[model samples]
Target: MGYNHEYQLALANTEAYWADQADRISWFKKPTKTLTKTDFGTYSWYADGELNSAYLALDYHVENGRGEQVALYYDSPAAGKKEAITYNQLLDRVARFAGALKAQGIEKGDTVLIYMPMIPEAAVAMLACARLGAIHSVVFGGFAPAEMAIRIDDANPKMILTASCGIEFDKTIAYKPLVDKAIDLAEHKPEHTIVFQRAMVKAEMNRDGDLDWIEVQEGVDPAPCTPVKGSDPLYILYTSGTTGQPKGIVRDNGGHAVALSYALNNVYGMHPGDVWWGASDIGWVVGHSFIVYGPLMGGCSAIFFEGKPIKTPDAGTFWRVIEEYKVNSMFCAPTAFRAIRKEDPEGALSHKYDLNSLKWVLVAGEKLDSSTYHWLSDLLKVPVIDHWWQTETGWPMTAPMMGWDNPSEARLGSTNKPIPGYDIRVLDGDGNEVEDGEAGNICVKLPMPPGVAWSIWNNNDRYVSSYLEAFPGYYHTGDGGFKDDDGYIYITGRTDDVINVSGHRLSTGEMEEVVSAHPAVAECAVIGVNDELKGQLPVGLIVLKAGEQIEEEQLQTELVKMVREQVGALACFRSAIVVQRLPKTRSGKILRAILRKIAAKEQYKMPSTIDDASILPEIEALIEARGAI
Candidate 1:
């Protein structure tokens, strides 16, 4: 880690380093001036910047008094539900939902849509539409209501936020009739539709005049709206496309609250109150910036959970809510520690209780596996970290800076550093860089830092053909991996989840490490599927372990002779199937593009919080009664 030439001169002091992280939070009216710079092929950054972040994640902790502390701690799954709110009840439910979006006209460059779940009144309707300057977009309550009518008809929103159904792992669902069928086909519709009932069983609203957020905040009060800059537009997340289509990745508002309080306090070092949980499903993009605006702009108390970690009422509800909330930074996705180490491994998680207040578990969207990183780091002795970022690198552009770093400086699989305010490179396919230990095309060389992701919402030629003309001035993070000899990075997954075959491109994490070192393998995905004679081969599926029954033709001939003798034969196995569970993403990501769209029969959308899409119709009826291999 020698690159500390004084933290590389505090990482090349970008305009006095993000204006001293925009004065370490707490800014109400301030923002007449700050960042506004430009170019990574010229657009601009900190560009015309000015601050707000709902005045630094909720009226600067209640205009500095720290308003009764506890900023938000919702819970759900019906059994006596839960709430918490505070930071003055999150500044009076984000100023009476920003005075019910200015009594419905919804001003400041409109566009709303938030599409609920992972409730705290859906983060008080996304901080009351950023306390009124509007422009949110959220979506991800497991998408698919035609992927929420394709981002509610491409962000043609005008206020939509919802609820009236939420429970997971057991199913209640509703979601205000898929936001009233995406506001009755929103090419226009969203003139208002708030909802927020949260599992209000059999809930069927929109009986007529859309707008009932507890009857419009029952006689409003907290007004405050109109104040935006730091390049306004603070929302719109939508990216789960599994290789194509879904885009809309924008981000703004004081660079998404100073790049999510500078990457949730320097990449999961998090602090303030620190309960900080982020199982991410507030509809993706790490549940819209680390489960609701980076742990409430870092005041910290944040842990929402409409429940689902292996059936809501089962498989140890995320170690029973981190042993009833002593949680201390547990972020998620390693497809959920390989589905809870296949239903509680030896860490039996202290037999279901007192989790010595967890301690920075992190891991993200994909690629943690070094066997789910030493199985949740030997069942929570803690320290797992492994990040990597996307949805156009809005937040974590690869992490591991947790105080001088430590996940054994994570090499066995990577995504370690370069998040001190992003500069990560790694190019190839003709952009340049890639030298140290090869594998490239990861790009980001811009002045784009503060919550990166800056285009695609209004589609500037799809933010310049999906991230800057493929690889021109470098932004092309369509996944690929690299950096070692001490830089760290390591993504190795989505470069269209690579798999060439006859030409041998490989990597479904190198055939999920030879079918997770076989012996009746338990957790696997290694997709690519569709192969007439190897256009894309490697397909493993698997689930086993408990009671371990081995015999899908002898575990698919020992996972196709252990990937044709450890990593060869174009990484064999175009089929293995056997599953009891895999679907994941209650913050344990493995949907393997839904087993590569059901082994390429195609047609896949599924997302509505997937606690179990009916165990994927029994793993797609055991892969159409196993006939093809």
Candidate 2:
């Protein structure tokens, strides 16, 4: 069936449509009810179903006679290692790890925080958590101790799983020190810390609860899959909040399995034994959904890459992997392609490898500019699909479904039409639907599709206030965009304080918190400015205290160091300009929107509510002098 027919059918009979999709996965106990309302008044999918996510991803495939097929191809250029793990082999490791966790008192319903790099063990730890029906929260290995501490306090995991170090380009960052520091800072203490030691760095097991990863499973038998209700959370992935605190996004097992399976077959058109590569870090939602759970559950071989797109060793690395593994489809952020494009403008490096095996190239995590979209399409000679979704959704909300008999044509700067289950609409400030071609708040009508986050971890009120309260009956996306007359959706960046920097969603408020903490700064506003490679980069505009005296150069250096030390290097907050004063409204709210426009060199009118109109030119002059753009 075509996109229109399938999408209409889903909306016409939401329950029946999803019920059909749920049948694609093996369930321990099949669900009779499809969609139901929870105590929080939000909708949940497959509430009566019982399933084990790890079983669907591993054991199910093995039981179906695909045990010998390669499930994960471990390619780590950073460590100079390569290996292929079959379904049976991966299942054995996961079961043993689960057994280890069980031996350490990590039973069902307990939370486990996994802090590791882009290695196969990271995937193993995550799947192992699922095997025991534990909720795993994977923090990006690049985050600072302070950032990790916040999550540690929030999630309050029973145990922490981490590697000794993470390699970034040429530098090997020891993670044990960071984890140690985070645990010291956090109020809640985990019962145990399982350390996965790499050859590059060996963590000193000095802590009272430290345990070796391999040693813990030595005497334990492999554990079996633990059955769980469909409403049971499989994992808690945190996303940056405008409040400078991260919000945990909960994904349920049954909906997550069904949605990803549907997305793999319909969105990307993958089959069993097909090689799929999601060139993203496991910490992000794309990694959780595509890199680990999605492909494995779909019975496809997934490449667990541990390297960058340009370096480690060249711009041709992605092409080489695709050629070597014969990857049928690959997904990554537009920022990666931008980096490769900058290094190899002619796409000469891509031609060195046989990329004919790569049928589709998908880009998400941030807006795909028209230039990058066209550049990739022309170079790859394939459908370069740009889709849009968030960590909360767990799967693509909109995309050009390649599996559809009559897929929508690719549109420049558009993420294409909504997927079958998403009823996406553009709304005005007053919560009314906006006309086509007019930029407005993008939202989804109520009873959001399966796989969408049901509630914030431990804070249902925050979830309701953050998402539902704004639009009464819709799930506010926090993104600004407009739908074209042809039904294609164009995402025009975030509508809130959060910004997407190189596919990583970070909060400007969080950066401001770090910047304002500097002694020389009285107040500061961090705005995301447009960039050629990173999509958006954080630029800090600061106002000094009345008697404080410091050179702009010195303050900039100090602020940069402070932000890096506090937020993490992934923030990319290098630019800081000292301003005499900040433009604010009469109500005392800083005019950040004006600052962003000024930094982008875009035209803007002075707001009538501005407390001081002349501050705009002064801010613009300072930003220009600093070359922050």
Candidate 3:
């Protein structure tokens, strides 16, 4: 039950391994070349391949007679609706949208920006772009006009797709006005704007360029799939940059399809006709891989959930959806489990559903603490797979690839072993391999897997300098961790997230793990704050379980003692304070950098992705009360 054979085979000859994966997808011209390298730190996989991403994801399944099976299950409690679309139906919608785009003068290689909610139209728009061999860039729906403008200026999309309104909780937020503002702000205005009229709110449309979505698709025929080279760009997903500009991470057509198709069977244990649900938004990389392309490539069902994890109803929302849809496997962030645990500590709401159909629950986005991992695993009686990857790398780099014949046991804190085709290493600052117990930078030897990003859009220099130049022949992950003697990788924290106390490096993740182990603590975040004496100190911001109470002095003492006993005195973990909630992005990633800024009383820019901007003031108040500000 070890992955030694698979891992060894892939690393021995990556070209052979990736070539076999490429064969899994249907192609017009099968690739004769596996990978091509350049002197400027760039690579192209399946160079001579000719295939359309949408054709493989949609047409292949329908031609194989699996069209009757469900392909998209959309449930939006906030919109007060629920529906499912079969493979045939999904294909028709995507094709019509593709035809509409073509009719508007969009051609292969053209870029389109899609900004919509968690509705099925978002997925359709992405597929439509792929079907016509056009690149699609999807921006998160909650983004403001200013934020949208920044992306529009960067990509200069030919067309923009959006909806009239998006429902969050019970409120209907208009999106058209924001699109119009972004168009006005951008130096390059899109030629056409297609609007999906939900009728939830009144929206003004510009007569010169705006077109109703329904009218555009009224009499158009489905466009034929365009066969592009394997290296053709599929999408551009932007990630936050340190220099106040976004990094446009580009995914190619052939390699992405091949890698994801391989993962459907190997990483997810998925087959045709099965249901897979990934409760992530289409704007992010996770949604691009899992919620849309991955499941569709496997000819399986994927859910598009349009509701908050907690406030949409209760912590029971996920369980109810599972029972209703009979979901086979589910994927969500670790913060979700923390929220569910906060609401129902004793499994009161979870026990109501029959999760027997749920074989696996995967957690990502952030490190899954040992306490939450064990709590939810025991409740569901299923393997809680903690996988690790980034936006640049489309799919998981480390995971416990489960199987019916040989099941893998859950390793509480580890993200299990590195997946095949990924040669993971822990290296020191000088690029030397570290001992098993020592923490260092996590890196991957070049060339990376097929699914890994080939380059940053329009910025080959940045791609080389950002990932390659840091460590000569390695892709610096920007994360710090260690590999155990048994080959299990434990991600300690981001290298930037490490706290330097009197020149001793202390991982905030390790400190957070110790503090979160306290029985009364529901969740906690550890941050490093500058100090005149120690240089930096670890501060714990805790959120206790519902109705749980303890004296502030006594609780702080307990938390300090826990860290001292576990991580030693060098941790400098003296302060602990309570907070009602932590600031997070809509994707459930904690805003630790913001917390660190508040702790050190340093100026910080407010991110537009924050779920609740109001909670930021609360954190500031708590910091001020503790004299840390």
Candidate 4:
């Protein structure tokens, strides 16, 4: 690499690089200066003074007169009804709602729970919390009352927001009634419950003090947002709970400001006026980061879709949206793509729409295998970007930044290169750096990548022990990475998940990628099961593509052989069990931990973040079917 200021400066001085990026944003209580030269990765940042996040997001655009531009394109699953809110319109609703929150005696530092679908009001609720300097915790609309109750009690939020229903598979389900039940379970009664009337359902308030969402929006003047400290918590996003209860991942305003722009421009390669759609739910980090904050902070159009893919009257729903909106960039998951391929395999996508505008595509959540990357790349004729970052990381820490880096030489199975100012590492159990070709636990050496979370919401202990103490001074990623000989880093597997079979270590990701490549396989996840003979064996679970009939014996032989060929026999998958779908989080990560418990004959206390957990029963049946063999 030549004397690229982008590389030499960002890579050499990671802290200063991020601090410099912070300068690009408006700050009220400006940070005195960048991270001290000595404190490297231990301190926090932005201007020293406090600032309101909603002001930066909603007001800043309005002050600049860019508020008239489309801030959010809201959609409902209901037919022929969509609402587009410009920044100014959105700001008015948020301000008044913030005033309403104040009327309920809500104050700074109080937590507000927002559980609504991808409607215009959801964004308003978020900004309202920001305007009031309250921390907002957004739960997926589909969550059960028991799940919602857990989050409410954890945060003890002063208020809760919901609606009557949300769209899934073209059907409407009541959301407010369940919320009414969830509020009953709260240890302390929420000061106010704001309910948006989707589906025009009659309000059934089990709680007497609950406020109708429609009435609240009726008569109130928008209040100017109050200022908040840069370090004040803006939002608390929970992690997908495949292993246990979801942990609330909190990110402050300064960190979010620095991160959102980086991810939008660096990962998605989004430019001003570009139509970008992130097919992620507003409940998850991807939705909060990319769908809303990323595009907003970058000053671009962030498209929001309200319905499901396969159920919108055809397999081409996403494609239709793209064609309609001229969406130039799209970010989704391999699971979503695979689901689409099931509906429109064999150039069905190429047949219908004018998709020529699509320029860049990014995939995350689950690992984006080489198969899906090439398939979408060839299918769309766009650069396929594979990225890696966890909910805790706050923003994408690794990717081939469009202009700053080259993707033509991008490494397969690798999450491209680290973003401008991140020091990504693969360190061993001893906390020492691992060599090329050697896999170790991934960690961020202190200060952290800009989007790196402030902590797990308010539970500082879990945050410290979960990340900080796990690897001593470094922030443990829990995932593993191996540097290639030439210095590119490839994610191998989660450290808690890598299988040790007969004394040889193997990456479940590597094994699954190979199994997925076999002609008969559609998708796969590798899990290590306890074996009396070998301590553990790598059993593979897979789903086959439609009409591509595959025999158990033939697939077993071919899938195992393929893994051996690609990653070595030491990493060969022991057994192949075909299932309809692998259990996963809404974020798109495979629930390998759940798979482990099931394989070990342990009962699973399923996490709240998994969307289609009913699919797990099919997995059990598939495993049982192969037991006789």
The TM-score values for the models, in the order shown, are: 0.34, 0.82, 0.98, 0.94
The TM-score obtained by model 2 is 0.82
lDDT (10s digit) by residue, model 1, range 1-629: 33355246546877676777777765544554555543334343454555566666767766767788887777775434877777887777788878867777787778888766676777777777777777788776646576677677788886677777766555567777767775665566666676755435645663565767878877777777556766767777766543546777777777677767777776677877778788766767777777777877787888887766665565677887887778887777766556566666554654758778887687776765566677667767767777777666667776666744443365667777676656778887878887987886778766556667667677666677667787776677777878887777777777777777777776788778678767566577777766687677776778876667567778877778777887766566647877776887555567676677777777776665465688777776776677442
lDDT of candidate 4 vs native? 0.75
Candidate that beats the other on lDDT, 1 or 3, i.e. the better one = 3
Put down candidate 3 lDDT per residue, 432-517, tens digits, no spaces: 99999689999999889897887887888888988988899999998899998988888987888898999998899999889888
lDDT comparing candidate 3 with the true structure: 0.89
CA lDDT, every model vs. true structure: 0.70, 0.87, 0.89, 0.75
Report the Cα RMSD per candidate.
21.6, 11.4, 1.3, 2.6
Ranking by lDDT: 3, 2, 4, 1
Task: Give the CA lDDT, 0 to 100, for residue 132 in model 4.
Answer: 86
TM-score: the better of candidates 1 and 4: 4
Summed backbone clashes in each candidate are: 15, 0, 0, 7
lDDT of 1: 0.70
| Number of backbone clashes in candidate 1 | 15
